[model samples]
Target: MKIVITGAGGQLGKELLQLFKEEGYMVFPYTKQQLDITNRAKIKEMIEKIQPDYLINTAAFTQVDLCESDIDKAYLINGIGPYYLACEAKEKKVKFFHISTDYVFDGEKIEPYMEDDSPNPKTIYGKSKQLGEALVLDAYESSTIIRTSWLYGHEGKNFVNTIKKLARHSLEMRVVHDQYGCPTYTKDLGIALKDLLTKPHGIYHVTNSGSCSWFEFATEIVTFLKSQTVVIPVSTEEYGLKTPRPMYSVLSQKKLNSNGVSLRNWKEGLHEYLKKEDDENGH
Candidate 1:
């Protein structure tokens, strides 16, 4: 099978690229520098030339706060990019898989969000992603959209890296305890994506099982590292982020489970990630 992965520089994209290659698939990884999805002419040119079986789009303007300031750039990349890919993929009859976020929905529901849940985004990033999801599906109903949350991986700057960086500088740190979501590991999500290829194409909520607040997640990271960094829990008001966020964006994996695919719990994924870091560092 031939696969084309955009946003190859990202955490999830890098993981998918490595996993696909290890499984012996003919995979072409393209970073933003190589293939800007917003460029429609370039997208068509590349897709026609490669004739890939699958095009996985992981490229996105994920900086939540920055999205508020850069609305046009965010919509251009996050909203319109997938539309271009879907149009080209549909014409070429290639399977298009788009990655999305839990932020698509407002934190109105206390229970976990299902795939069919109504999306009322609270931020520019969420709105743009929601737009992207719609554009992809409208262009090609056969396209697959996977909504994930709180992702961390070895290859990129994520919450894990941020906390570790802060830990190195300060003995104490404050994390918001009110916000809640599933923390997904890119390696595990990549495996889930591979499994998804066997199932029907549509929207699916895929993430590590279970959920926790940022404060709890930070504590777990520190505990795993055996670091003396003190984590202080604070409310969202105290954190005072300029951009509004979904307070409870935990997505249910019932769709994935019904498809006979489910990821491990968040804690197990985190443990493996830390272990991988240790191995890489020769610890």
Candidate 2:
């Protein structure tokens, strides 16, 4: 089967590419320079040329604060981009897999969000992703929209790498303790995505099994690295960001569980990710 992955240079996309290559599948990985998803003509042309059985879209304007400031760019990349991809995929009779986020919820609910829960996005980024989800589902009945949270990987600028970088240079690092979500390892998620391709198509939530605050995640990183940096916990107010984050963005894997696919616990996934990084760097 021929599979096309957008955002090929991204962490998740790179992981997916590796997994697909290992499986001996014919994969076409396209970076932003190769194919602009926001350009409908380019998207249509790529879909026509690739003739893929699956088009997994990982492209997006992901900076939450930047999205808040540049609403047009956010919508263009996250919303209209996916819409065009879905449209092209529909026309080509290919299965569409669009990655979404847990930020679609307003964080008012304390429990892990189910797939059927109503989305009340509180930021421009969340709203744009929500819009993208709607477009994907509406445009293609065969599409699978996977909503994940707190994604980090070895290849990209994510929370884990940021913490690791800071730990190497800083004596003390203050992390927000109040904001809570699952820390999804991109490689694990990449494996999950490959598994999901064999399952029935629909909306699924794929994240590490458990949830934790940023502070807890940071503490684990410091502890694992045996770094001298002290990870101090602080509230979101103390950390003060331009974008309002979801206080609780834990996503339930009930849907994936029903499909007979499950992810390991967050801590276990984290350990594997860190170990992989260490191994790669000859630590």
Candidate 3:
């Protein structure tokens, strides 16, 4: 099996690239510098040449705050980029998979969001990603769109690493207790993605089981690392993020479950991630 992964430098993309390669699959990875998805000509040329069996796009404008200021760049990269890839994949009959976020839905629902739930994005980042999901599916009906939330991995900047860094110095840190979402480890998500290859193709909510608020997530990190830092809980208003985030974007795993796939709980995934970090650092 041959797979092409975009945004290879990203946390999830890097995890997937390594996972696939280690599993004995022929994997081709491209960073933004190597293959800018915004360039349609490049996408077409590459797809035509490789004719890969699967093209997974993890490239996205993920900085929520920056997306508000750089609207054009956000839309171009998050929206049109996936569309261009979908079009090229369609032409070459390549199976397409695009990574998306929980931000697509507003925090209106108190319960977990289903895959079929309508998206009512509240931020520029969410809106742009929503557009990407729509465009990819519209261009190619057989494409898969995996929606995840609160993703963290060893390879990139994420909440887990940030908390670890701050805990090393800060005695206490404030985290929002109101906003809720599933904390997914990129390594676990990558394993699930590989499982999805033989399953049906469509929008699926893939994340570690269970959910928690930012404060709880941070607390978990500190506890796992045996840090003395205190994770103070605060409301979203007190946190004062420049860009608003979904207050409750926990995604349902029903679809993934029905498809015969399920990930481990968030805490378990986090423990493994921290252990991996320790091993890498020679701790």
Candidate 4:
């Protein structure tokens, strides 16, 4: 299987690229600098040249707060970019996979969100991502859209790394406890993505099993590392985030399970991730 992946420099993109390469598939990776998805001409030219079996887009303006200030950039990258890519992929008859976020839904639901859940985005980032999903599906009905939450990977700036850094520097860290979501490891998600290759094309919610607040997530990391940092739980209001996030963004895994694909629990994924960090650092 030949796959062309955009945002190859990102945590998820990097993990996917490595996974595909290790699986012995012909993989082509493009960073945002190399292949701007917003540029329709460039996207068309590249898709024609690669003729990939699958085109996975992990590119997006993911900064939740910054997205609010940069509305145009957010819409262009997070919304229109996927649409442009989907159009090109459709033209070439290439199977397209676009990564989406849990932010698409409002935090109104207390239960896990299914694939069919209606999105009522509360922030610019969420609104932009929701638009991207709609546009992609509208452009190509056969497109596969994967919605994930609280993703972390070894290759880039993610919550895990951020927490680790904070633990090392600060004695106490305040994390928002009110916001809840599944913490997904990019590597695990990459493996699941491979399994979805032969399945039906549609939106799939893929995340590590179980959910936790940001405080709990950070506490896990500190405990694993045996750090002295005190993790204090804070509410969303106390955290004073400039942008609002879905307080309950746990996406359901029923669709993925029905398709014979499920990832390990968040704690397990995080433990392995930290172990890898330890190994790399010669701890």
Count of residue pairs whose backbone atoms collide, per candidate: 0, 0, 0, 0
Encode model 4's per-residue lDDT on 1-283: one tens digit a residue: 8899999989999999899999999999999999999999999999889899999999999999999999999999999999999999999999999999999999889999999989999999999999999999999999999999999999688889999999899989999999889999999999999999889999999999999989899999999999999999989999898778888999999989998998999999999999999999999
Full-model lDDT for every candidate: 0.94, 0.93, 0.94, 0.94
User: How well is each residue in 1-283 modelled by candidate 1, as lDDT tens digits?
Assistant: 9999999999898999999999999999999999999999999999989999999999999999999999999999999999999999999999999999999999878999999999999999999999999999999999999999999988688999898787767899999999999999999999999999879999999999999999999999898888898999999999998988899999998889999999999999999998989899899
Candidate 4 residue spans exceeding 4 A from truth: none
Model 3: residues >4 Å from true position, as ranges? none
Clashing pairs in 4: none
Record all residue pairs in model 3 with backbone atoms less than 3 Å apart, i.e. clashing: none
* TM-score to native of every candidate shown: 0.99, 0.98, 0.99, 0.99
Q: What's the lDDT of the predicted structure labeled candidate 4?
A: 0.94
